[model samples]
Target: MEGLDPRAFVLGCSAIGAGLAMIAGIGPGIGQGFAAGKGAEAVGRQPEARGTITSTMLLGCAVAESTGIYGLVVAMILLFANPLVGKIAG
Candidate 1:
């Protein structure tokens, strides 16, 4: 039997890794959107609380953004440093 080409196998692994990495974005996107809506509603209900609401909302957004950042890091690793490629090569 013939063996698989290293380059083709590596490219396929990279594609799968990229797809898996992007899946992480789902959490942050939904969480941030929900936070934004809640912030808008909070400001609507109590205009005087705008300062506090905005601060809290921003903090929530920052936390939520971490997931997206993690996803980006994974994607970068998959595209650039693909550890699986090393294992396959070895």
Candidate 2:
């Protein structure tokens, strides 16, 4: 750390943060998979309710997917439009 440039420090930290942010995508993937599996089970149990089950599952998946999208956006910002880099005056 003694000889590290301020800008280099900021850029390195931003890269780490962006990597961490990308991990957030995992949760939504798991949730959507679980939802789909459950939806399939529900439809199997009640074929007449297939439409309702599928629609609800899709809606839930869409909502869950937003978190992943947000995480992606944040990661992209951290990697490309990093504000912290600008904050480091030198």
Candidate 3:
């Protein structure tokens, strides 16, 4: 890496970091899906409680989705406004 440009290296590493940050989305997705499925099952078992179950499920899903949204925001920042790239003394 003797001839490697620092700015280019930082940019490349930021891209990789952005990709890894995106991986954080998978857990939230899976959790939200599972919560929805269980919520549906719960509502099916007690139709009268559908309103409560639905509302609770939606809230949980929203909370779970926030993590994925955060990951997406981090990835976007890394890709678009990468602070590390500016730190390189080019």
Per-candidate TM equals 0.86, 0.87, 0.90
lDDT per residue as tens, model 2, 1-90:
698899988898899999999999999999999999999899989999998899999999999999999999999999989988778764
Top TM-score hit: 3
Clash totals, every prediction: 0, 0, 0
Order the candidates by TM-score, highest first.
3, 2, 1
Off by over 4 Å in 3: none
Reference-based TM-score, model 2: 0.87
Order of models, best lDDT first: 2, 3, 1
Mind giving the per-residue lDDT tens digits that candidate 3 earns over 17-52? Answer: 999999998999899999999998998899999999
For model 1, give the 10-residue run with minimal summed lDDT.
81-90
Compared with the true structure, what per-residue lDDT tens digits does model 1 show for residues 6-66? 8777878798989899999999999999999999999999999999999999999999999
Model 3 clash number: 0
Question: Between prediction 1 and prediction 2, which has the larger TM-score?
Answer: 2
The weakest ten consecutive residues by lDDT in model 3 span 81-90
lDDT of 2: 0.93
Taking every candidate in turn, the Cα RMSD to the unseen true structure, in Å, is 1.7, 1.4, 1.2
Clash pairs (backbone) in predicted model 1: none
